[model samples]
Target: MKSITLFLCLFTYFSASAQESCMTVENIKALDAQWEEKNLNPDPEFFKRVLADDFVWVHNHASMIDTKTSTVKRAEKQAANEGSDTRSRIQSEVKVAITGNTAIVTGFTIVDRGPTPTRYHFMRTYVEVNGTCFLTGNHTMAIPEGE
Candidate 1:
């Protein structure tokens, strides 16, 4: 009886952990929405919760690289200078793809800060770690003005 009870307990624990590790499209979409919201309105807690400690972001075709610490600092700075610029952005054509414990999200965004809007293409990579998802990597490319 003791042996059977221990086996059942182990099985139940593993099952729960497996379920928690599974990533769905809806989950990715929700996370993506949170990322977008943070971008528009900087949230330090959101960044801390979602980004991995070693997270790295490459921007504008590698013109800039940011680590998790740098990102948080930049967001803090942006939050401080909030009223100086009227910048807002909208994301579109977003798609999520999952493979094993990793997910890749790609999208296009248009930022309106002035009379002319600038467009960008972005990709974010998320990895499941101990039943939680964290943004591990990010890349962004600017779309040329015309085509």
Candidate 2:
């Protein structure tokens, strides 16, 4: 029937459009890099854009999880530090997974943790809000010293 044919066409069109709207690897990387750059430069406003109200972060070296408020306050305080070593990181093996409006970014990063450099594998999850990605979870594992 014409009704059945029209239904099929509509379904196909919608399905294809939905698939096209899903996040791509380059899009994920660009959005994530924006947040990273803001953080590296120590901007408190970065938290406003990239974090949800319920954001939480698990520090690799900390015994406690950080809440959005706590993390923002800490970054604000750190922004005032003068003459301190500027931190840098080298990232690799990055991967992104998207599910509906949620995305998970996983990667390995080499950071100067102390007097020596260290590698860590990290996972961060985000949800798209108003077409902008907002981080909701974070975890990182340090790679072994020799490996």
Candidate 3:
């Protein structure tokens, strides 16, 4: 009876942990979608809410935008320059590991493709602050032309 009870408790704990991990993945996916929409529409308020105040965006070209305000402004400017058709379709595979209230998400983002299709792979890290998730940093690597 003692062994059975212990096994049940351990199973329950592991099940709950797995559920939490799944939730974290879902949250990351939602975050990615929100960012994509923000980039497309260029809403500073939405961008601000999604990203941490001290968020920093490191472009694949080595240009970096530090601060959420600057990042949003930059996104707005880029959207304006590209017109309404500005679409950044990201193929992100998120892996989230949670520790207490914080989770680390690592993923690749593939951006901007026309009829011919060109893509860039970026390794991004996200940190959760006060129950809100924000992109902390990133390092991008160019994939092969065919890939």
Count of backbone clashes, every candidate in sequence:
0, 0, 0
**Which candidate achieves the best lDDT against the true structure?**
1
Error of 3 at 72 (Å): 1.5
User: RMSD, model 1, all Cα superposed?
Assistant: 2.9
User: Model 1, range 12-82, lDDT digits (tens) per residue?
Assistant: 99998777753778898789878877888887778888999999999997899999999888788878878
Sorted by TM-score, highest first, which candidate order results? 1, 2, 3
The lDDT-based order of candidates, best leading, equals: 1, 2, 3
Q: lDDT score, residue 101, model 1? A: 87
Off by over 4 Å in 3: 1-23, 78-85, 113-116
lDDT of each: 0.87, 0.76, 0.64
Q: Pull out the clashing pairs in model 3.
A: none
How well is each residue in 1-147 modelled by candidate 3, as lDDT tens digits?
999999999999988865553237678767766766676666766766777666666765766545677877776776667634555656666566667655565566655645544465655566765446777655556566866
- TM-score, structure 3 vs. true: 0.62
- Give Cα distance to truth, residue 81, candidate 3, Å: 6.8
Lowest lDDT 10-residue stretch of candidate 3: 113-122
